[model samples]
Target chain A: MHDSPDPGDRRDAVCVVGAGASGLTAVKNLLELGFQVDCYERETAVGGAWNWRHDRSPVYAGAHLISSRPLTEFPDFPMPDTWPDYPHHSQVLSYLERYAAHFRLGEHVWFGTEVVSAVPTGDGGWEVTTQSTGGGSSRTSRYAALVVANGHNWDPRRPTIPGEFRGRVMHSSAYKDPAVLRDRKVLVIGGGNTGCDLAVEAAQQARQVWHSTRRGYWYAPKYVLGRPADQVNDRLLKWRLPLRLRQWLYRRTVAMTTGDLTRFGLPEPDHQPYESHPIVNSQLPYYLGHGRITPVPDVTAFDGSAAELADGRRIEPDLVITATGYRPRFEFLAPELLDADEQGRPDLHLHTFARKHPTLAVIGLVQPDSGVFPLAHWQSVATARWLRLRLTDPARAAAVQQKESAKPLASWSKRRVVKTERHWFEVDHLDYLRSLESLLNEMEPA
Target chain B: MTAFDLLRFEDWTNPVPPADREVVSLLPEEDDGRPPLLFVPGLGHGAWAFAEHWLPHAAGRGFPAHALTPRPGGDLRAQVHDVVQTAASLPRQAVLIGHGVGALVVARALGRYPARAAVLAAPVLGGWSALGSALRANPGGTLPALVGGRLSLSARQLFQSGPPALTAEQITGYLSRLDPKPRAELLRRATPPRPVGDAPVLVIGSPDDRVVARPALDRAAAAYSGAPLMFPGMGHDLMLEASWAEPIDAILDWLTKQIK
Candidate 1:
């Protein structure tokens, strides 16, 4: 499969897509594995999320991570303990920068290169196509191993608001800081964590803040009783129990653990065991309690300053923050390798390696309340090991792929583990790491 | 419990006593077992806060329920210790619930004991961070230490004097049950560098919350990689308010969906 490196090849050679967390990890690990690697990042700099500052950065410019330092960090590499429990978006970006530098991943990355297409060539190798993010440059290269570490948040998902809204409207992804909504009547849409956080922040600065949710939501306080709510809830749901009983228990447990909606001027939920919103903290209710924000109904339509809700209520809003979630963006890929379900999300197998092909692997695709770093780290390790095996021992690689292929795509939570069903790729970071290590061990020659 | 034991936890207070160590008593009858749901309370609150709000609602809705409170009486740290003790005693792997300052404690606990789902509500994140200072400065008694660890009865009586927006009576009863030490200690624990777990998170928040604020919860949830449930009308005492049932139900519903 050696097509022949140009008579003079100065570039050290493994192709990595995107220089985000997973991509960087793969690059670092590849170096550790002693392979010459080439990393292709669409962004100009090494930091992915970090580089996407509100002004110049793309993808989660205003967004901060939900994962904490200890859990967000790598197994061997620990983040500074001094960082807050929940670091700001900038801090995370900064941390990624530090990680890249420490691992020396910056030197190998081609900052402006974005992978446009990848095809498996003869001899089980890959031919890659690229477009420059800057200078409009285009090029093609071939690599023995390909690691697609392009993160999941690359694409933006806009909601189909049944009716048009005339008020100043923007997606949560477009929201950078709360400074833009000063003194205006702001309506924050969506029941997700970002919506809640933005609603709360806007409540303080805007003349009025209206948060709308179609589904009844649970405002999970960061702490319960005297600890973080996740710890308590996770503990309770981590068993073999009836789903009904578990839901019941979860309701009672959270209620006892946190405060009620009245404190925030919001209506009581109609449903039991309200769905968990991925909000960062629980203290948001206090802002509502103090009359800083108002919780309204789902927006049905809007005409200028006034917006109508599904509940038949109309409220005037100066601005509307549609923190409506996001979708996966894989525009650069060819139709053959890129297949998405009805939701437009790439139909990944185990959420990592592409289902249709094994040579092409995807990492950091799973969305969790905790940070993707842990998962990304383990995924990179697994992909690396798998690639190594495929290169040295194709038979073993084929066998492993066959077994992975045999497993059904939809499998989940024998216990109360919450993960996307389509991306049934959730793993306990620690367990996944160990499993990856074992897989790596099996690949070594005696 | 001794102070050191309170610090070490597990050794001093076991959520479930040794005698209560039963194997798999609460398994789901039909579906494959999801992780257990463990609920931890935020600062100045106890498991009773949730029970008062959820129990009546769950019963009305025909949902079976249980609320683990701070086993009758103890200091703040002791109650927190007891909570950890009692929670660990339950079946392994449950969704953990934490609110306000309590979210930090649960984060630490999860750091020690990994769970299935982590739902942090209106969290204060690290109460000692740059933003936390502002929250601590607010007059919500979140900073009970500023008034000295021991608040006078008249001063302590003021939290109830404010309004009926929340079930003040329930909040009062909850406050009357607390001893000074754990309250201060609990607040102190809500500082930066709070522990974290790798479980999927469902964060609940309100923009108008005064004490903990949305920024704190936002940052905390962001750290956890959790999905958020934001509302505009809720107050800091959400779990205890009249509108609390909806959010509580939402959390439970999400847990079921998540595990399924």
Candidate 2:
């Protein structure tokens, strides 16, 4: 950890937005890195979506873990062995509470304080706009650096469908439990985990279900050889092999054991499999193998009681659910400050600091093939060191790095970055920890 | 009447309409010759709910009507206070008409205040009558949770949100003439206590109320020792349903004859 920030220098505070698993880790790292940090969360409690359930908000409707508990736990904390293979929503919340308490992060956090906006002051600092529900107060604060830790999923991406078929249509985000779907013939569009989960659950209640996907997608189970696929993949990614060979070997290994999409009713894809979805972690493939969920093709149109697929098959449905996906939205970020791709995901170099914005950094935006909690913690630690080096020993750091074969930590003002694909299939959690520690080590003055 | 019944009163306080200037002015200038009519709305409803339903009904009968909506804490005593406040503001005397949860409020008010008379239309009673009973029993204990959980899939609940379930045309017409206050103040009058005063009381029931349950409304009328007029096809939301005007006119005619 670097030298602690002067508590008296209130202006040196690093504001962490969101108190989710990622945000909490970021705050913990900032504290350990010797930076004064304050966390702002939109929810009244910690744990983000997990807290939504404990808070009993409707937003918690049907929350399931995309990543299993064993691989999902923080490095310092392990989940209780008594828990089932997959933890329930309540159990996940309990674990998040434990993580927060373990780090003593509650006092540093401002609950019910939503970060409405953050803009660069052009002086290498951030002006953060926040609304605090605790005392009905709205205020803006200046910070040395800002961490945008809010996760990018959960917001609904409305699908384009023909206007004629209107039974009762809502996004999967709006779906709570399947009780409201009793005796109804439902059509679930999208073969994503959410779509598949809803299809399987609804099949138990609804008279019939038609799950529509663009094409067949491979279903990877939560576990491989009695252990998590993530755990196995994590080890391979960290091995000392050529990046190209590793990518090829990773694909071959995944295909050998994971099997085909037919286990889930999806036909083989005609083209090479590249997921447009930033994150493709789901237990749907496992459910599909058990005949719990059925899959179909893309939807062409809907006419009242009937849905027409692109393949020319038509079926009657009493309800239609769109489990499409969510687009990344930086509603609170300044327009000029946003770095975005054609797909609307904020275009960030290394998926950390925005290419356009210097003092501003985004954490937990990547939907990693592995769990995000560990990645977010490492990113926060690297970021805290990056900020502290700029404030303290930039000249000495540049000279020391110029002498070493490995590149020195670049100044935030001069760093060049691009959006790198998250190599979840090849990542080891421990390898990532060591890599992040090395990056932090370089930032330290010799 | 049981001690529980004797302690209840009727509600006769009406709500302030929404911010619609046209509806505010549409209210006819107060007439000194006519007695005021106080309307108490049903559960999960506010004064705005009756803006179109009761507004025209009251106007057609040469009466000025106001609806009392539920507030955060709607119990029997709080309901009685609303009636007293409405009566003080309006003409000296007003006939109190409560429907569903509103009926319990009106009953509580009449037992406590000097109202002209009281009428409960399809008062929520029976095994499902836990709403009023729960409020009277535990005022501060998880009311939103109970109501939100139980009233899961009602038309009102669905339409209460964005774009509104009601037709856009209806909103443009009546929503402008509504006040948010009285409706904001009413709560679900959960159970019934008998009216304390010997005020004339009339209870109305419907055979088809899957939500309120017909047997529950029956027990309420039976407990009052009052004969309830039964409407075979009417459901819980009597005021908004078709053929409601006929039954409402019948009640008015009966009221006029009894008053004379």
Candidate 3:
């Protein structure tokens, strides 16, 4: 571990990594709170995951917001009412660009510049080294605070299958167009939202579409009662119903809307609805029922073009699309800064504040069931306020720090811990939002 | 692909069957001092059609809202009885809001049971005439929907001239939830009588609705001696459309005046 720097000698400049939704939000909030901000983005544009044109973006040609527009858009700057209940990926990118331009966040960001290393300085600040993608000279700068908003979707979590398949195999991140699956026998692994979406897409064009899942996931329709599902959930929060009742209602609603999953040969959900992130695709079940797509058990092994299922069924797939999801990686930061808990998640308070470094905060690291934009907005607000308080009022900063430290650290893990690497940072959207709101209230005092 | 050599542990847990109720309450059943509201969906739709936004908003406004899914394969009269019984079983005399065929059911139920005011959204008035108009507008869709035991209209037909913000995924999701209406129900000669009883009616219509013609909506409103609340350039699915709040706000305002 690097030696600690003196707290009194830090500068006032703040270094924000990535120019994605979280980064742009941090820049706007930090600037509003009178902090000198510098943001770095590896891509040429501001929209991160929404930027379908960006090489690193995991969004495919048919990508759209899983959550509804009202729930996903920034509360302060909402998407137009004329837009559909759910907007496409291109529209989401345009919205993000509009947000950046509206807040003048682009001026503070360095496009095509990647943060190579972010090391803690001896003076309670950060020394950030950057390298331009154009192969120019590397530059190093020092700032009093560090904000990691690089996002977690860049690193693809590829699943391993036994034996070797000679057919084409690709991760979902590399998938850009459905034309690739045209007339090919395609097999999609994983039953998350993306996997189900890709399977449905392939069903339209592929010769045959087969979806494999290890476990059952609660599937939800994007719209219920002519409104977005997330928006309905948000309104239901006002009812102040007990948690059990709420879960029961959610399960009943889902069952009625989606019908039976076992009827379509899909495994029934192992846990209750809202226990983990439910698959919000409505087409998967419809396609399965119509025989356009076949649901199979987990893959046991691969033998050339023939793939063996756990139930001993063999399928000859021409193409394999792995929609297994992504892993969170921060190669620029020291490994010691992110100490993992028993669940392999970093031991950060509220999944934002670094345990050892008071000035270091991470925004948009959480996986919420609702739209991530609002959560990112609230997180940036809290982090910016806390950083400002640390400089102006040491006593208040200490009090806030003490409050965070005294609270139970692994409360979420204790509630419902799923033994999957993908669910390491999974959080119930409503529960996480309440925590973020409470933290913001304490930091801003209003 | 190289990451596959590692031993992976499989966590197998028993799957739990979901609740078996067809009716879903958006808010708790406990009375919140406001009149309860029962929502009935149109042909080919389940209770989820209103579960997305209307039920929650109405619930938030102090009205405990509930949605009912009419059992599949029932005749029109039987389905109407199912809806009426659901409304009657509520904690108190509840306001009935219905869409399309559901509106027709509410109109008929008004004559059979005592209730508060009713809001008919895109009501199918002059039953045969409305059906003719729908057939003319969607000949390719109408015949297949009826014969196939399900109704499946394209997203464009459903949300005509409305916001084009819905992703393809959402459109498919929305379309997948459209259940099949029984052929016997469609052929049954059971149109509700015009202006059944003296209950105040608020008829909602959209000019851009391709599924139900504007003239039919006007006639439906005229039958009840009520003014048609027209939302220009909107689609047939008013509750799910982009300007959903417009009709909701109108209903709330009209409900306030009717209560007074």
Candidate 4:
């Protein structure tokens, strides 16, 4: 209710939307730089997606961080040593709460408040409107800059089929328990990590399980040589082997461990290993081999409790769960501000700063193959430093902005082919991390 | 009981049996079927290796599979004789599937016996280039196995750093079950039979195989005029590897076409 200082007096203030990992990091970095911050979160608590208890969270009962804890945790605040290598969603939420308490970030955040809309003012600033979740009262405030960190997993992209089926159908976001699959023939569609996990769970309880995938994916075990796969990848990078030799060694290792996936009736992966997001599920092959789960091709159409496959096979299932993934939705901001590409991915410099408006930035928008927390942390730091540099030195800010604008989108995206809409914002974790480090280095105060 | 239980050594005093060169048969559900499939192991490996997964899979697919375990103390000639004798005992012509040094025995034995078809999975054709690559990849294992009378290779060398699905305990258990081979047999230069005859041959190779290079496999396929099928990312142990079914399926498809 306008209890803070006048917007004109506090021109160095920044408004952060969404109190998620990116939002919390933005608040911490902005406050550390002595910038007054106003963070708005629709939820009553911190830990946006990790807060599995929240109604808006897409996390399910079986959800766990695909990346290990060490890589996912903030560098300044490491997860507890007692936590498992792959901590559950609840543990992640707890770790986020601990991070907020350690940095006193909750004080800067406005809990139970939603940012209704944010529009760029003509004077290189932002006109933000917020409303409390409890009351419908709207508040207008002006800020020197705006950081959108609302994340991209809330809106489920449910694909429409040509025909209708006489079975219970729901998106993976609506699935919370394996009880729905008990004693029923369940068809889990999609070859992503979520679909694999759900298929593994249903294999044990469902009367029959049919897994459908449109394309093949490289599946890696969670552990390699008794250590996490991501950790092994880091160690391998330090080895400094030639790219060809490294790829050969990695291919050999994967073949030895995962065996030939084609034997399990799945199609051969169309791309090389690590070329895209790998499905890291160890139990998938085991279940497929044991005949507890059957792998099928993509669904071409549905015929009353039966689904027709693209390969000319049909399956009669009692229920179907679509783990088809989510689309990046930023409805709070106007469409014109995004300048999205043909794939609907926003044209941001280094996946962070806007080319037209350097004052407006987006953090944690990438779907990297590995942990996103460290990447998000570095991105927020770069953004905060850039904002400060823009205010203090216009020439240097313009130079940095020019370089970012010239950066090619092809260099940022490494996929040979983007198969689905969900992969539109995908970034190779190692490449993106290096780019972030360089951007951070360039943004350092002279 | 596991094949290891039967072949388990009591101590140094108790020597292995000489008559243990008998063929171990894994018949399918039906009594009579098509020609049975015969599997031959490479250096330092026993019939138990194929028994792990391949034999059961082939038997389940209605093709009775058999593994030929050669007598302990023998040269390459004697090993080839053992394979020939085992094939003669089968009621009908059998499909020959050989791996590593066993492939050499199968190549020699095919000249003397009648086989429905042959599937060579990572065959060691003993060309200088192929031997050079094998030695470079695994000097510690390959050198000792060739020079000395004992075959010594670690689990890492055997499975090419071990498969992911198998735990350390499982690998150790498998390693414990392995028996040493006669070095003279593994080191001897393989002389390909004058002509491989009219028997259809399928040569399966792994491009990433460290033990058996693809060049040697290519040469073997060329010599036999066989259809060469290469699995791009697979390692040497095609039968025991996670994707063992790929080669199995290929062999099955070839056999189906041949029979028709």
Candidate 5:
């Protein structure tokens, strides 16, 4: 460590903005690459959103991982095989804790410390300001690079309907327990995996449940052929099967398992499989087939205790939940730093590297079909490799950056995703991981 | 594609089954920032070999030492999985020390697991000389190992049989606990795996090692470290043989002074 500097100008240190899975792994990889790192976390503990004790955490009591354990775990450090296919949120939290402790990542992290601002100093370094989570005066320090892993799920994105509801209306983030839905009529909006999961929970606790979706979607079962379905899909991708055949196989499997959506009085899928984000929910189909939950078209407006469906049908409910998803937010850094548009969606090169500033990267801003942790892990690995290349040979690193900047955004999934706000960051696991592997080759070739 | 890119997807989908092996550890009263050391014992042995001497010896000097008692398997991949899985469970990344066939296991496992550093002690690795040495030292064991049968090793053949020889009861107690391997799992005809990335490696053994020759250790050092740190007059199982403390002291010196 540098002895002392005026206001601690640590030229070798990289400032990381979170201690979540992405941030912790970033610190580990950076340290492995011989770079000093100072990670700041707003919460008192690590695991970020996975740690349910924190107020910003989106984890709920009924939550089990939608993706199976194999596809979800970090590549270097896996969850024990004793853990079931889909582990509970508490288990995931413990796994993250184990990861943090094993790698000694906690020592590098500054708990209860939050980065308030990070501005580029025009000399390829960033001046980062920090403040304690509790009331405290802010401190500023300068570092060589910045990695923004302040996750994207904490912000609430409650879509505006025509009129306000007279009764209770809340975002899914607030619905942490089944007690909120007990003996109540609930209306849940959106068709994301979380939406399906919340609806499934409502089936157990609520008096009546209604699920509203903007468009009919293909629902994949959590398991296929008695194995985790994602594993089966990954195998098909590894073999490089024809896209149409894979999609057909996926549709066939879902049909064989759950039958057609219309058979259960739900609308037929409007889009092809893989055109949007996957919703792996076998339980949602069971609840729907058992007539515990009713499927309806998207809600257009809220009138008192009633939500008017787009098909002109109205359903009255005690609680209306807007599970419309979250928008990625980076209020500390300038919008232009991340190349974020008006909607605050970062236009990162691989949904990671910032072309405007090669030293800047934003990890965990993706919504891949597989687990987010492994993707974040690979992203950090690639980013650390790039930064080390810069440290050793700036001219070559700059040339690589120039070549990479001209390439199109690396979001190449097998299926052409519909350009929608919800699927803005959607990526196929195989395609994204392949792109990252090739990108890593560019910085650290074999 | 990088080795990791191909293995990444496979490990995620169809991982190696979790290894149900035994682990023995020794801890220091005060840690002086030394990395943990994990030892994989040679063939026809259990973790008891290291737990007997090297573990307490290393830990006494403030290093956390561990040993893996791998389950007997015919395939090399199974042993590699055992080593990698046990290392991942540790509180820190360990300096992996492999002995005899365990050295080959550690080498292959580098493709899958990252280590703080590595040491191949009395390595049964590289060249036809290793087979030739094994043939000359114990024709009875080598002939059986070559034909898919367990190698027959008398206790004296492993430990130092000259000065500080093991007593008859000491020999019998250790022999009874051996985890013997079949011919399919021995070191020769091995596929070369990815090398350890950037971590410093130390190849330390003895020229007097009964089961391996000087040329074999030199080749192992050639593959990893630039030069072999030879501890002469020690047996093949350096961690268990007579003059064991001398080799371990050199290892501790290297870990503390050389790597840092």
Candidate 6:
């Protein structure tokens, strides 16, 4: 409740809004560039979505990386090769912890501190207000820039099924343990990664499991021929093979691995491969083949306790888990600053820089087919580089900004993924990373 | 990555898996604020080389000195990964000092880890340069090595100490500690990774070393954007000679300028 700016307020520092994977990387990169950074995390610790200890974390007990370690690790700080291809959630948390420790990122981070509000000061600086997560008077400070990395997966997006179900229903964010599904008839909705994962887990314990999806997805196995499939898949992507050839190869590979998912009584994909977010699940097919689970279409409506599907089928389930994805939420900054659409999803340049407010940017907003951390790393690197230019050479920075703002942001991939709420921030991992690398080259080539 | 880059890569599709590493250390009693020095050994060699003299000398001079050996398996990238990991495991940012095949590993590791500084001793760098030197030095030994056999080094092929203190018996004692059954490094054809992070480099080698020729030294130094600092009369095992303190002292002196 200061009538004037606090004596401690400083515009020389950059404020990073989270201490998760993206936030830690941002702080590290900024500090490496000699930028004074003050990172604030609402949680008591780091790891963001990967840390199940946080209330907003989505990681379940059995959560493991769908993206393999190589593509997932930071370009500079790679995961130890001794680790498995797909490390467990605990491994991811420790990795983030070690990264913070290695870079001394924790020194810059203010744990248990939440950014209350961020308002643009008239002179291209941010007046960021903060409060302790336990509730207290807000402390106001001024920062030259704000890097919002509060993650995109915590805010659950629930699908609105008509009518009310008497049975227990929960979002995938709330499905943290399999003990809840022990003998219950579980209907896992949405054929996304989370949905497929929950479905497979349910088959091991549930009395009967029904997987419901709006449309079929290309179920890529976690592994292909004893190697992590993401690494194997990148062979074609790295080769930059024509899309048709790549798709044919992917189809052949998937066909060989999982065979036709439709043969398991699941709906076939309506769109071409790469048109939807890939669902990596090797066990779904196995469970389906073993007759432990049933596949159904979208839930049309819920009548009493019965769930009616799009295909006129009815399933009475004890527990209905919605694996529908999440929407990005940035409450501290005003919506207009992000150039956000009606859905509150950001329209960031390369899923990072803000076109409208140059001082306001977001990192790790992207959902890449591969792992999200390395993309976050590169995004943080780009953000740091751009910020350095703004501080050292304002003229060149403004010129670059002008050009970037005028280019009319294009889809991250050559071919656009289906325009859906879930694909709001989806990107072709290779294509987007290549673009970021090229941009970095243009900015300050290594 | 271009096709040339792809060919140079072990496998862009299936990256060489990183391997385990064993590090031998000799720490100073007090921290002098100098960066740690990590010693990467030559092919068929282990950490025992640097652990013998350089590690103890560097530590005595108030630097955290350590030496690493790639756990006797995996490809060249794995070797590089082992070095990078060892550097990271050090207490502070490390000054990577690689000898022979390890110099090549350090060159590639520069593409990944950003060491504070680098030092290459009698580096096996350029493909043709290394091959030409190896064939000329001992064609009979080089023939079996090309087909994946260990290119065993003769006592003379390794040691050429000019100092009176370095007796022939002492040279053989040093060689005795080496892994006798170690495989020959045939990765001289590996693409030289571009020096990254702007770390200053020091290439110290001997023109008299029969294992690596002067051309290889020049190529390694130029690739890292540095000049070769020649120490004549020494052999490939720079740290195993009677003048072992010379190269480590030179490196320590360079660190004093570049670091503190």
Q: Best by TM-score, which number?
A: 5
lDDT of each candidate versus the true structure: 0.59, 0.60, 0.75, 0.76, 0.82, 0.80
On TM-score, the stronger of 2 and 4 is 4
Residue runs of model 3 more than 4 Å from their true location after superposition:
A1-10, A341-344, A410-417, A444-446, B1-260
Q: Give the 10-residue window scoring lowest on summed lDDT in candidate 6 chain A.
A: A1-10
* Candidate 1: tens digits of C-alpha lDDT, residues B178-240: 542334344454323323223577788776665555666777777766546885666665676
Error of 4 at A237 (Å): 1.7
Ranked by TM-score, the better of candidates 1 and 2 is: 1
True contacts kept of 1: 0.00
Model 1: TM-score, first chain: 0.85
**First chain of candidate 6, TM-score:** 0.96
lDDT of 1 by residue, A277-334 (tens): 2455565667766777777776776665688877798898878888766666666666
The better-scoring model by DockQ among 2 and 5 is 5
Listed per model in order, the count of residue pairs whose N, CA or C atoms clash below 3 Å is 177, 41, 11, 4, 0, 0
Tens-place lDDT per residue, model 3, A308-412, is 999999999989999999877887887667666443357688888898898888899988777788778768878888998888888878888888788784443
Model 1 chain A weakest lDDT span, ten residues long = A412-421
Cα miss at A412, model 3 (Å)? 6.7
* Residue A276 accuracy (lDDT) in model 3: 73
Clashing pairs in 6: none
Worst 10 residues of 3 chain B by lDDT: B3-12
Query: In model 3, what is chain B's TM-score?
Result: 0.82
Worst 10 residues of 5 chain B by lDDT: B1-10
Better of 2 and 5 by TM-score: 5
Q: What shift in Å separates residue A340 of candidate 1 from its native position after superposition?
A: 2.0
Model 3 local distance difference test score = 0.75
Let me know the DockQ for model 3. 0.01
Kindly give the stretch of ten consecutive residues in candidate 3 chain A with the minimal lDDT sum: A1-10
The local lDDT score (0 to 100) that residue A221 gets in candidate 5 is 84
